[model samples]
Target: MSAWVFDLGNSRLKCAPLGEDGRPGDVLAFAHDGRALDAGWERALPMRIEAAHVASVAAPALRVALLEALSARCARIGLASTQRAWGGVRIAYAAPERLGVDRFLAMLAAHSRGGAWLVVGVGTALTIDLVDADGRHHGGRIAPSPALMREALHARATQLPPVGGHYREFATDTDDALASGCTGAALALVTCSGEAAAQLCGRPVPVLLHGGGADALRPHLPDAVHAPALVLEGLGCWAQVGRTP
Candidate 1:
């Protein structure tokens, strides 16, 4: 049995099929503006798709449309949520209903990997989630992404130009001041959040970084491991469990 996973985020929709090894096989990403599913998906759906799972933070209407399209292509469809319990870890959100499903899914993947972990997702927004060694979720933090930060700065102030460029490790020089500063701040927040989560767990926790901005932020995150397909990984995990009973 094969599973298709879709992670619909604020800016993009990422879809992938999981192979027997639980890794993404045919991965495709599209903009959030209601584009058709990739042609590959059309060809792949007939190849015995047993289940489909989705996580989205899009508007309700858009989410419905996405789900409907997915339903047309698969036998079973599961909506990912922050409220569900998988294995041992349970979501600890103050308002679990309001928590982004993507964060929850990512944390699920992180917890499955074992040990204490801080999962940081940097996309349109920054999400930091902590899972202890005992598989207990410890809540999380959210903040504006680097792009959102730059946009806010530009929108609020008259002097600062819209900052655009890749993040680098050394930014003391003038040529990369704005880009470096923004990157540095984002990385600082991620590391600090990880450190804080570790402290709360009473031990050091490994950091798993995911999302679009991860590559750009990599230079500044020395202790973080880049796990680009975490959402898909979680989806695979979900699919595997669904088959058992």
Candidate 2:
């Protein structure tokens, strides 16, 4: 049986189907505006999908729409949550239901590979979550993404110019300096937060970074493993649950 997976982040909606091997196939992405539902998504839906799984950090309305769409295309539809336990990881969020499903899934994906891990998702917002070697989630931190931070600065300050370009490591002067500094700040927040969590967890956690901004932070984070599709991998794992003996 095939499975359809959707990861609805604050910025975008990513969808894909899983093959029998539990790997993503036929991936498609749409803007998270809710208007994209009626667009050509039907054409993108695979045939013979038996189950559907979704992870969303958006409004309840958007989640409902996504589930309705998937239900129309599949026999079974499921919503992903931070509550599920997998491998050695057990979620420790004070309000597990309030925790972002994407963060939980990413942590699970990191843990599946084995070892203490720090999973960072850098999208509309930057989130850093930790999973210890014993599979216990030690919680995490969240901060504005570099883009949001830059935009906020430009929006609030009249003289500050809007900056746009590839994030560089070393800035020769002020222009590159500001851009690099903003980007560096975001990366530092994530790294420092992860490191702190690792220390609290009493283990050396290997960092797994994901999201669109991951590449920009990679140079500064020599210790981090880049996993662009970490959330998708987690979605695949969620889709497989309860399907086997």
Clashing pairs in 1: none
Global lDDT for candidate 1? Answer: 0.77
The TM-score of candidate 2 is 0.87
How many residue pairs clash (N, CA or C atoms closer than 3 angstroms) in each of the candidate models, in the order given? 0, 1
lDDT of each candidate versus the true structure = 0.77, 0.77
lDDT string, candidate 2, 1-245, tens digits: 67777888766788777777777776677765644454676676666578878888887887787787777768887877777466446888667877788888898778777878888888878888888877888777888887777778889984666675455678776557667878888877876877697678776677899987677678878988998778888877766654656
Q: In lDDT terms, how accurate is model 2?
A: 0.77
> Per-candidate TM vs. native?
0.86, 0.87
- Model 2 misplacement above 4 A: 34-38, 84-87, 165-174, 201-203
